[model samples]
Target: MVTDTAFTWSDAKRECRNMGGVLGVPSSDEENKFIGQLADGVVWIDCNDLEEEGRWKCREVNVEVAYRNWMSGEPNDVDDEDYQQCFTFMYDDSSCPESWHYWGNSCYKITETALTWSDAINECENLGGVLAAPSSDQENEFIAQLVPDDWTWIDCNDLEVEGIWKCRDDNVEVAYRNWFYGEPNNAIEEDCAALAVATWGNK
Candidate 1:
């Protein structure tokens, strides 16, 4: 789905990702015409030539585009004006920094910056992702390796119904939980979840 908010190519991709989607990829002439009509300004579709110039592919997926509707004389490889690599539209996936470890189909950007639950989540959102969500033992183990002794903002919270935690990304109540020793007492002010420091390693 295309967003109404105007953003740079990178920002647009990130925004759609946070919403669990990729930018729309119009795969046909009819679809392209429809999108062009639906848009007010230039709406980014899923066309990009990131890997190879002039060899375009739909950003929403990795495979090469089966059809193209580029305007005539468009994509003129106008160099020197600036580096225009990724296209103005459509969804593509990701590759996190080397510092980020990949596990269970997701990249974990573990950092030491301390922030409140809300602020932490916001920071993550700005980075094109959400606070980490661990729904299984394997995923939890990955988190454990990254944060064994210190707290980190996780995706579980009782924000919807105190004492009933849920995953912020999916809005589904958690069926598995890993609370600290004598924790989650529903402290009048505590609605968020954190990984309690187990051994105090990096602080």
Candidate 2:
């Protein structure tokens, strides 16, 4: 019963209960493997330490998490952010490529040479990645900070269907957009989208 749509942790828990099940809290190695395989990507489980740092518990069942599978050096509270206590899982334990930045289960890197959106897509593909396609505000900010004060090409476009944008990386319809005022106007039949000064437009 994996829901592909994104939801806050609480919302997810409630949704799970509504379906007559609790949040997926693996209690054993086999359960962990099953849940990890079920969730092909980062997914919210029931594990969190919000009540007390370093004391993880499954909120739905009100039980301490006994089986742990923390990523290397993880659960260490990266950047010491107090709210970094929730847990998600995937089997991806490999490291990111050299010079590539890692965040939210993805690796990112900026290109040295400038190219048109089409060429940029090819460049990234050649390097074993897609053109950066941020799916959330935090991810957008992460990419923006990578190359501040400059426009960067993301894999967003409406070329396949005017006004219907998607991230070419996975051809998934974009659910998050940060458009500039009066932008995406498709001026002169514009199709590609880009981040301009941290705002998005198809100009």
Candidate 3:
């Protein structure tokens, strides 16, 4: 309910954590309504299944969700991102319209809007997938051919520990790498990396 702040679900939860609070999770219907009224925009709730798909945990207190207020047709497990179920509340209901592209066994989509690494990763999860990680060379090449923009975010990042890259979805180290020449010098504080459209468009 911090109106002065605008943040993605994960970031919002982190914000609350930093404040020695978890993003608020209403344990009752009355409290849910009160929280929804706290802001004109959707408010992030402390509930998600970042670790285990189909299982949700409260971000604040580690409790199983008992109360409920999901918008209709929600928790759809969209785009196969079954593990990304971060919850949010708006005075009115809201959902991100997902557009998907089938790639092998996975569905992929580059967000129309840009979000920070954490936010992007979270958003992708909530949609039932992780930010696309090409697990094999062929998958990488196929994904490379689908770029429609000058740049797009990829899930690999070294934010938690420099020089060690891992997939956001499972925290598994990347088994393959195709870094651009002298790439990942991390010339700036750009800890996040992505599949640059210009760099990977042709495979």
Top candidate, metric lDDT: 2
42-150 per-residue lDDT for model 1 (tens digits) = 6666666766766766744455557665455667867521223223222222455667765444577876687888898888888777887666554565576577766
Judging by TM-score, tell me the better candidate of 1 and 3: 1
TM-score of each: 0.47, 0.53, 0.45
**Per-residue lDDT tens digits of candidate 3, residues 5-114?**
77777687678878887667766554564454455655667666677776766634765667766777766768754322224344433232346554443566766776
Looking at model 2, residue 67 earns an lDDT score of 72
**Per-residue lDDT of candidate 2, residues 1-203 (tens digit):** 68988887788888998988888776655455445545656677787667788776664377666777776677776555333222445545357777876666667888889899999988988998778777766667667767887888888888878898877446665678888899889999889888865678884
User: Best candidate per TM-score, number?
Assistant: 2
Better of 1 and 2 by TM-score: 2
TM-score of 2: 0.53
| Backbone clash numbers for all candidates listed | 10, 0, 6
Which pairs of residues collide in model 1? 23-91, 44-88, 44-89, 45-89, 45-90, 46-90, 59-91, 60-91, 149-197, 149-198
